[model samples]
Target: MQIKANNPDEYIAQIPEDRIPYFKKLRQTILDNIPKGFEEQMSYGMIGYVVPKSLYPDGYHCDTNLPLPFTNIASQKNFIALYHSGIYASPEILDWFVAEYPKHCKRKLDMGKSCIRFKKAEEIPFDLIAELMQKLTVKNWIKIYEQTIKK
Candidate 1:
């Protein structure tokens, strides 16, 4: 949803009540497993895990004022969306995630280039997401971003 939140907690608070637990768990999953150097914040109106500007002063190429986004989770109108920039920039990571999805969840994988959409709340594979979160560090991500995505 289009939550007018100023921070990650505010974004979580603004999500629908029924989804609060799911969102919270998703947030915790990322927080618990994400590599160091990624800070939590509200990014693009969603709960974002990012490389803060302090660490990477260049910031996101698309918007230098914003932190370098690594991943984001949002409660969308129809589903929960997880956006992972690493998977978008690295084919090896993408292929690994794709191959491993079915092993973690029963539902068919519903995904885009960088967005993984979960239509059913209970079907979200938090463990898989946690594993994905640990795959990249700020240094690795910036390198990949520079080599494959930054323009």
Candidate 2:
């Protein structure tokens, strides 16, 4: 995706006007549910929730200046995409998401590794996503991230 904005608001503004409402709803849920120390910013041309540099001075291994990415939300051309490192890194979480999504939402779960692609806002299982978000904290996420890197 193109890096169209440097900040969250700018990123949201760049979203197709028709998609703004869905993005806003998802963004707010993310902000409200994410564990503390995760900073909301524009990354990979989307709204990203990341572990701040203050919490992880080493930053992301791929880009030390950039904070470690936790999750991201983007309004793609055809759908809304949610990228979550926790779900990708943990098989248990991934399984839980896959299983619980259908139980909670009527739409079929459309996902790949860490990315959940929803063609429409209603297709998103917001409650399930919130539950997943609440499952990990900055400390827990860093530990998991490091473990993945070591392997």
Q: Tell me, by TM-score, which candidate is best.
A: 1
| Model 1: ten consecutive residues of lowest lDDT | 7-16
- Per-residue lDDT of candidate 1, residues 1-151 (tens digit): 5989898888878778888898899999999999999999888988898999999999999999999999999999999999999889999999999999999999999999999999888889999999999999889999999999997
lDDT of 2 by residue, 1-151 (tens): 4647878888888878877888888888888899888998877677889999989999898888899999999878788899999998988888888878878888778889899998977667777778988989999999999998623
* RMSD of each predicted structure: 0.8, 1.4
Let me know the TM-score candidate 1 reaches against the reference structure. Answer: 0.97
Q: Estimate TM-scores for all models.
A: 0.97, 0.93
| Candidate-wise lDDT, in order | 0.92, 0.85
Candidate 2 worst ten-residue window by lDDT: 120-129
Off by over 4 Å in 2: 1-3
Alpha carbon deviation, residue 50, candidate 2 (Å): 0.8
